[model samples]
Target chain A: MTDSSVPATALEVRLASRPAGWPTTDNFEIAEAPVPEPGPGQILVRNKAMSVDPYMRGRMSAAKSYVAPFEIGKPLDGGAVGEVVSSNSDDFSTGQQVLHALGWREYAAVDASQATTVADDLPSSAFLGVLGMPGMTAYVGLMDKARFQQGDTVFVSGAAGAVGSLVGQLAKLNGAERVIGSAGSAEKVRLLTERFGFDAAFNYKDAPVGEQLREAAPNGIDVYFDNVGGDHLEAAIGTMNDFGRIAACGAISQYNATEAQPGPRNMFQFVTKRLSMQGFIVNDNGHLKREFFEHVAPLVREGRLIHEETFVDGLRNAPEAFLGVLRGDNTGKMIVNV
Target chain B: MTDSSVPATALEVRLASRPAGWPTTDNFEIAEAPVPEPGPGQILVRNKAMSVDPYMRGRMSAAKSYVAPFEIGKPLDGGAVGEVVSSNSDDFSTGQQVLHALGWREYAAVDASQATTVADDLPSSAFLGVLGMPGMTAYVGLMDKARFQQGDTVFVSGAAGAVGSLVGQLAKLNGAERVIGSAGSAEKVRLLTERFGFDAAFNYKDAPVGEQLREAAPNGIDVYFDNVGGDHLEAAIGTMNDFGRIAACGAISQYNATEAQPGPRNMFQFVTKRLSMQGFIVNDNGHLKREFFEHVAPLVREGRLIHEETFVDGLRNAPEAFLGVLRGDNTGKMIVNV
Candidate 1:
């Protein structure tokens, strides 16, 4: 790869404005910028894929959250995987695939220190989903935060989404007695039970979450990996056994709500059942990355774990892809192929 | 003392009927029962003081809770301190003051194993409040459940109540930078700061808990000892700093509600602030008793701690005393002295 072959200009996605409610494509804009050469200690990469996650919604608004809000008129950044087209650092060479936080763009001049070299054994998109942030989020949220035990009954909401899809499988693979999941649609519910090896799955929209969760987990759940808060959280609390643990990963249900949604009506059960609920951000738990990879990478390599991705072609459609993620349109990891 | 010294017939408070919402005196019955002699390995105790706690309300109803419901025609049992008139076991001696769970009665024949002899260093009523279940609850809830750290800002609801009153003092004595409390009455609010050493105090009824808590803890609270749930829990969640903790000791506000109430609406803050909320029952954490006694008993003995009690004379008025507890009429521990 030479400087002559690299494109002079490339497209990137920017936040046009903040949305009052559910974001539309109009909130995003595609702008062209000159692709730059790698400076000292940097690598110029041709981005192959980018991730569009539900958490990014928090960054879209100006409200203070765990992560800083995305600046308007600047290209949005997230998990991305690309090939090093040019390198000016000893850490990387041309043609090597690296993962970095420079997504929603065609090419990025990433600092070599910031980008990590990923193995060629898996698809580049795998770095954005299964072997990346979502995968680690699932591992830490269940194994550590929820303190999942062998033979424990585990329940996860948003069963078919990126992080959620892996949570049920991880619990099952780790010797869970029964794995239950709640999803928005029958198809996702099917995916949860059949593909993810969950013992029971329910479409949360079909009936009240508490009723369905009770029917699905009659004995009660010991560990709850909460991705969809609101009714799902309430149902989990209601159906939890004594000393149950709740990993508050995300509250996607209330992300776009104009008003703050009411929490579980059965919170008093927290005292009665002696339940523990903890909210966490995956970024803070990077210390567990090596342990997570050691356990999960093999599962992905042997095809024991499902590494699903729902890809939307081209950086131009990244906004639409993000919108699809918010609408629960994607079954698993929703990715944008640049 | 001899068996003849023990009264042959004693007054006992019984549940005449379960209440729908707010309980009235009609819901209770003052009955007479023959006080029995101590059986093998039993002690005949002349009840001195009995605890009239908010938790009794839960047992009054037939609803499934941590403990079994109070039988309709039987005497309600709770923490009570009494003088043993006769003992059949070597563990206790006659005339020894012991604490047992045979409250709401003038005299009780208790199994020696169920009664523990309390020291005379503190008032007999202290065994039912600061040195007993409520004391242990405050200790475990703050020290273990909430994992309180030195210099942490602490907030406790129901600050004038038994369990809550001790929580603020314990936190302050253990080197808390600030201790904020919320009570139901203006006088209780005054008592929190003036008598209990709380840094700031507010009457929750005077304003919204969120606004008042925000004003009290401008930098945000690190630990919330929740006794009154509902709005208090929500407000605490809102005013909590990153990595804050909530010890859900009790939900006295919802104990009498006919229907389940909605929980915190701003629960998303749990994730945003990386908060941890744990509900606990003091019975489960009995392992920490020795540690609690070592730390707290000294405070009480030295007069560094306040063990206030509002006593209602005679077992005939036990139900009224319990109702007073439910109505938040007591300053500290509500007791029925027989």
Candidate 2:
């Protein structure tokens, strides 16, 4: 399509309705729309990769969350990586790959100046997975917010997910004496310890989180990056050392619960240990943006940071990929390759 | 007991039994012992007043808390104010008022070197209140831990209690635009608002703390000095603004809960608002001793800071004073005048 072209487009899945317990196939729908034209300072990019995360479930319902809920009959937007096909601005060329908050669509006309340019050294899809929000979240969370020390013991929950996998690797790279992780399956546990270089890994189904953590971190946990809240947070609270710091990046476990979650039962432990639990969102904590790119880019180029992405081909399968992320079916980043 | 010629003799109270919930008169028993002879860097003092706090509940029970539990059949120690009856060292002298952690006792033979000389210009009783541990707790929690800033709206629970009262006054002095406090009775409410100059005060006994705080701080709260956790903490959570700071100073409400407290059902507000909740003990942060005294002395001297003392007549009444503090009956610092 040319820069001025305005063609009709169809999306195979828009959030049709909010889910009660778990969002079923009925929660999303296939829809069509007229393709938008590239306005001034806009460039039309054919999306190559799109993301679906557990956090998106909170955005699907109309309830209040860190981000707004997805509207009915409208395409859900997340981190997207794509190649520019048509442009009306000097900053963007027709062939350059970029990353932005583009919706699950066949094509989009985004402002050329908006969104970061995907680094030229890596695969364009990496922009949607590791080198994007998830990567920044791990880096900034570990170094800036959690203030993890060189020899600190770190525990990451939902350790096989996109952010957790990276968090484990980064913790080790940052000179953590020990890195422990918990995932849903034995295969994920193996991957975390062996492939991701986590010092210890456990399949949460095999044992209670408290027991698993106690065995894994005998000296007590110094830093905990909580992804799944509920019982995982409870366990971490039990095992934290004095002056402990916890970065509450996400709570994937209780995200889809119809009823409210019972918070960690042993919060009194926080008082005993003089702990600090800070809930954070990765919004480029100003100085960490530069540090993150400098540290992560080289690791990526050297293949030290391995990325695994589950891809669903075409715009039609985007809804299914998103559902898969909420189900924890994806090994790492769940992406739609449209 | 004379300093040079008279053999050292001292009167003291020791812990007899651990209490179930509230400490009683039987839990303590008086004992006569040789007055501690001050060695090198030691001072002998005659105790004038002693401080009792809610945290002493943990010390009495054998439950693990921020501090160690008191040994059974041994004297319980905490912030104590005394006049040095005899001195063997240069740091202290006869008739000089001093402060030390020597509670449930009269006429302590503390090492001259161990006691901090109560500032000359400030009230002697202030050594157990605003100029001592309680005052230091309020300062550090507000300035260093909470990172409270100008124009912030702050809410203090247990408004008329020693730490809570000073927290409200200091918040106002530090340029907080709105300072709200919650107390148990109408008289406490009046004391907080009218006497202490709190922007708003509500009797928590008559109303839900959440509703009261919502009405009092309609705009939202920026900092919360959480002295009485449980429902007060839940209410504070509901009214916190984005990036809110909560200083977990004390939890008098939750301490005596016969059953498990149903945690604030809406704790996810921490995630949405990006809240930071940190627990601290003043003694554990010993590095701030000089800074705390330096900051508080001038204020106490100028009458910018006022400390209320709820005094019991004798060492025999120490148990009742401690029990009264546990029941939230004390308006300020609960002390035993030995």
Candidate 3:
């Protein structure tokens, strides 16, 4: 028998095929591979938890995007929080917890330089969600892209999702006059108003998004965080105030669409209202990492910044977790525990 | 005639009815009104020339826009160049040439503060075209809205129009790496390349805009001055480089559509390329007026900047002139010789 600290084999989830539209279990393959040894400046990590985000849907396709596509027959990589089981680098020691971008496997051999040493006070999984990419996406989209002002009325689509939930909360924390959110389900809408402190929330499926948005934000919104694009974008444009800003983040509603989705018909409002719409990727704003952590880590520790995770147990179920994320089956950050 | 220089009655074009879709001559009424005497801080001017632009289409509609809707049965207003016939303020004197926003009329009683004195070296008509709103629109759209870099590869739609024509030239003068333009007809396309010094020009009517744009800008464009939106906007988004910028100057193609026009289908490119799109009115950027005139006035005086006007004679034909502009009848600035 091997030592309790070391694993002989690691089970990994590999991309079996590039998805045509909506991904299914057949697109992924579970494989057993020999645990890799740490090379020079590398550390062997026993992953505790990993993230499953909507952005992974884009990487599953061969199309060019902000990040490189996940190659078929290769283990998928994403945000992972793990404990160092062995180290070949002087910067890290065994038992230290680190966050790295080498997930979907029980164990990962990652470069020590690439792995960030996270604080031990909060759950290590928090580094994969609220204190990680999802959190940073919210911060950058609101502060930098949307240029959130102190008293601006803000609207956020996909308010139940990881990034959107954080965006509505962050806008409130930053002193927004009113925060409105749109979600797919009634429960998610309730969670937005009751848990995330949104001023108003609505189920987009209940009525036409344009009518609901107008009712919720009667005065018009100064800022809009777009996560579910299509109709939400059209509605946002309809009620945008003069000089309003829109941060185009994700478009999950259109991700699985086989045909080209129709764009906002009222785009002329952009000129009439002098509005600005900008699209950004969090990877392009890495300079804000230190600032994001400094501002958010404290709020997270004090429980002022709430976070929730719907964890699917085991690395073998990582593919299912990702599929769940795309289907909006999981609330907050969808995660997989190894 | 009482006096050739001072007519007893001013012939004016009034908005008889708000246009529903495409406007016709019936939408306007030619009326004769007594020439007004100048009040305090005002001047009575004999208009020599007036402008008819695409933006006027929006004003013709009752819809709220950057500017107030033109009231029915009231004389319409736009850029005009004239000689002051009478003055009640020290800012202007009789027989002095000035530029003001009181067009669609043979004579106007305008506030002296509203009129700007122009040099007599250039034709009075030049003020309504090259040295006026169109010129300022191109400058601000390129420099301020698009945030054009010195070496940016620029793409301009409606390249034969007043704003688009100047945008292509200004981009070249401002040190653009390459400038491409798209126009409706072969003659206008040729004019863009041969006269306006565009690196390449295409007749959008000749082929699919996406395919033409791809061939013209193989390496992708850094900045897009969008005068004609819809298909042009879609094509521009397809071939835009990383961090490309689009200045939404006008959407002339969609301006008269009876129903909601389809927006660019490839807007997802905005996120993938980290692009920014902003819409603005020249009035919002009044702060840039001094800077713009300082830089461009000398260019105009030295003939370093070129301009063209397709003048339709008489106040009675002003409605036809405007209709011609909507039909892409004019090659450059469509003007009315009053």
Tell me the DockQ of each model, to 2 decimals: 0.82, 0.61, 0.79
Worst 10 residues of 1 chain B by lDDT: B1-10
Give the per-residue lDDT of model 2 (tens digit) for A239-327.
Answer: 99999899888887777788888776666666778889888888726567788888998899999997788778878777777778887
For model 1 the TM-score comes to 0.98
lDDT of 1 at A76: 94
lDDT of candidate 1 at residue A278, scale 0 to 100: 94
Q: Kindly indicate the candidate among 2 and 3 with the higher DockQ.
A: 3
Clashing pairs in 3: none
- Write down the worst ten-residue block by lDDT for model 1 chain A: A1-10
Give every candidate's TM-score on chain A: 0.98, 0.95, 0.98
Q: Clash pairs of candidate 2?
A: A12-A30, B8-B35, B42-B111, B42-B112, B43-B110, B43-B111, B43-B112
DockQ of 3: 0.79
Q: Candidate 1's residue-wise lDDT over A114-204, tens digit each?
A: 9999999888898899899999999999999999999999999998999999998999899999999888888888888778888999998
Report residue A63 deviation for candidate 1 (angstroms): 0.9
Instruction: Tell me model 2's lDDT, rounded to 2 decimals.
Output: 0.82
Better of 2 and 3 by TM-score: 3
Alpha carbon lDDT of residue A40, candidate 1?
88
